[model samples]
Target: MTATLDHQPIHSWLTDMDGVLVHEEAALPGAAEFIAALQQYGRPFLVLTNNSIFTPRDLRARLSRSGIDIPEESIWTSALATARFLAEQKPGAAAYVIGEAGLTSAMHEEGFILADSDVEFVVLGETRTYSFEAITRAIRLITGGAKFIATNPDVSGPSAEGPLPATGAVAAMITAATGIRPYYVGKPNPLMMRTALNRIGAHSETSIMIGDRMDTDVKSGLEAGMRSVLVLTGSTQEHELTKYPYRPTAVLDGIADVVPLVEQLTPHESVELDED
Candidate 1:
C-alpha cells in the first residue's frame, strides 16, 4: 500500500520483540526486511520488551541465534527499567528479589544490595524455579514493610512451545499474599516509556510506540504523550480493537507496513511529520 497524505513518518520507533519482531525462535514474517529498511534509512529505533528474564545483552544473543542480529545497546527490557527505577527510588537499598539472573544482576548493577534482612524493596519478575520458600520469603519481606515492585504485569507470554506464565502472575501472587500493590516498570507504565524515549534521545511528539498490546504498550505511549501504533501480530486480534479502551493512532498487520510508510519520506520530512 502507498503512503497516505495523512500518514506521518515516525522519527524514533519503539517496538515490542516477541510478536512484532520475532515469534519464539524465529524472526516474524517481514521482520528482518523491515529492520533492514529502517537501518538503511538511518532512523533511530529500539527494541523494547517486557520480558525480564534476560538482560539486553542476553536478549541480543538470543535474537542473533534467531537470525535477528541487533546491538545490545539497541535493546531495552523491563528488567533494565525496573533496575533504573529502583536505583532512583532507593539507591543501594536491600532488595528481596523473586526473579532470575537478569533481574538480580540488574539490581546489583544499580548498586542495590540483594538481601532478605531489612529489605527495602521486594522485586518480582519471571522465575523459572519458584519454590514455596521463595514465595514465603517474598511475603515476609513485603509484610515487614518493604515496597513491592514488579517488572511487568503481563500474566502470560508467547513461547515456541506455547503460552507460559509471565512475571505478572508472580507479582499477583505477592499482591494477593501481602495486599500490597507494586510499582510496575514495564509497558503500560509511563516510567518505562519515558526511559525508552530518553535513551533514544527523542521527544515524545517525535516518537512512535508500536506493540500488540493495548493495555501496556499503547496505553503507555498515550500516557507518555507519544504517538502509538498497534500491530496485529501478537496478543491483540483485529476484532478486539473496537472493545479496547485505549486506542492507537494507527493499526497495521505488522512492522512491514511501517517500512513503506517511512521509506516514502526524507529524513527531514520524517522528523517533521512525527513532530506533528
Candidate 2:
C-alpha cells in the first residue's frame, strides 16, 4: 500500500520496535524497507522500546535474525532513559538494580554504582522472572530510604500464550508494599521521548513518532510535541482510538506504508548491510 503520510515531510523519525516493526520475533512486512528508506534518505531516526531485558547489542542481534537491520546506536530503550534520569538526578549515585543487563549496563555507563546496600535508588525493570525474593528485597530497600524508579508503566506485555506481567506490574507490587510510587522513565512520560530525540540531535518540531500503542508511544509523542502515528500492528486496535482524549497525527496500516513517504521526504542515498 502507498504511504498515507503527510506532505510535511518529517525530518526526523522516532518509532517503536516490537509492535510497529516486528511482532514477537518476526519482522512485520516492509519493516526492513522502512529502515533502509530512513538510512538511504539520511533522515535521522531511532527505534524505541520499553523492554529492559535485552541490551541494544542483544536486541540488534535479535532483530538481525528477524530481517530487521537496526544498528545498536539507532535503538533506544527504557533502560537508557532510566539510567540517564538517575545520572542527571544524582551523578554517580548507587542503585540496587532489579533488572537485567539492559538496565544495569546503562547505569554502569553513566558511572553509577550497583550495590545491594546503601543504594540511593531501587531501579526496577523487566526480567525473565520476577522472583518473590527480589521483590521483597526491593521493598526493604525502598522502605530503608532508597528511591523507587521503574523503566515503564506497562503492566503486562504480549506473550505467546497471552500477556505476561511486565515492569509496571512488578512496580505495583512494590508500591503496595512501600507506599512509594516509582518514577517511571519510559514512554507515556515524555522524558523518554525527549531523551531519544536528544540522543539523535533531533528536535520535536521536526520529528515524528510512530508506534503501535496509543497509550504509550502515541501519547508520549503527543506530549513531547512531536507528530504521532499509530500503526495498527500491535497492542492498540483501530477501534480503540476514540477511547483516548488525544489522537495521533496519522494512522497507517503498518510500517510498509511508511517507506514511500520516507523516500518522498528525503534525498536518496545508498544504504547497505555490513559484511560482518
Candidate 3:
C-alpha cells in the first residue's frame, strides 16, 4: 500500500485498466482496496481503456477473474468508440478491418457492412495475424481511394518480454505503402474521451482521469477538458514527466495513493496512515 495525498473532492473518475487495476491476470497491489473505497463512497467511475482487443463483457469477465468486480456498463473500450465513429461517419458503408474479433464484432453491431472488395474505409486495430496478404490488401484498398482509420496511435503494448508492437505499427506500414494518414479514434483522441464522459454522465469539470501513460491517457483527459492524474505504475516514469510538453494535474505512485487523496477532499471520510 502507498500513502495518500490531500486532494479536492472528486465526484467521478476515469481510470486505465492494464496498469492501474491489473498488470496481467494478477491484480496490482492495493487495487482491490482502491476499488472498495470508491464503491463505499458511491462515486461513479468508468474503466476506460485503449486496448481494443476485447469487448466490454470480455474485459469485465477478466476483471472478475482477478477479483475486481465491475459492471459491464462501466467498462468503456476503444473498440466501441471506433465502431460508433464509423457508423456516424459512413452509415451502411463497406469497411475492411485489420483488427481482432472485438473490432470486427463492434463494427458489425454498429450496422457497418464488411466488404471484401471495394472498401470505402480501412480500419486498423491490434491483431495477432499480420499476414503479408492482409497488408497487401490494405495497401491496395488505400491506393484505390479508401480512407484509413486507426483505433489508437500507440506503437506498443506491455508484455512479459517487454513492449511489443501494436496496431500503430501496422498503420505505419499501410501509410508508408499508400501515402495516406489514418484518423485516430482511440485515447488522446477527443472522440474516445467524449464517449466515456457521455457513458458516465459526468461533467468535464467534476471528472478526473487517472492513467500511467502521459501521451495517451493523460493527454486525452487534458484535451477532453478533464483533470488528469498520471500514475507511475506502468509506462511512465517519474523523471520523464519533465520532458513532456504537457503535465498532469496530479501525480501518484499508483491507485492506492489516490484513495487517501480523495478521502481527504471529501468531508465525511477520514484517512489514517499505516506503514506496510
Listed in order, each prediction's TM-score against the native is: 0.91, 0.93, 0.90
Best by TM-score: 2
Among these predicted structures, which one has the highest lDDT? 2
- Runs with alpha carbons beyond 4 Å of true place in candidate 2: 1-9, 267-276
Task: Estimate the overall C-alpha local distance difference test score of candidate 1.
Answer: 0.81
Query: Which runs of model 3 end up more than 4 angstroms from their true locations?
Result: 1-9, 261-276
Candidate 2, 91: how far from true, in Å? Answer: 1.1
Candidate 2's TM-score: 0.93
| Candidate 1 vs 2: which has more lDDT | 2
142-247 in candidate 2: lDDT tens per residue?
A: 9999999999999988789998999999999999988999999999999999999999998897788989999999999999999887888988998898899988
Worst 10 residues of 3 by lDDT: 267-276
- Look at candidate 1 and give me any clashing residue pairs: none
Query: Which whole-number lDDT from 0 to 100 does residue 205 have in model 3?
Result: 71
lDDT of 1 by residue, 1-276 (tens): 222324344577788888888877788877777777768888788899988888888899888888787889899889989999888887988998988878988898999988878999889888767778988998888898988889999888766677788878877887898899888889889889899888879777777888878888889999998887778888888778888776787778887766675576664554222211
| Model 2 local distance difference test score | 0.88
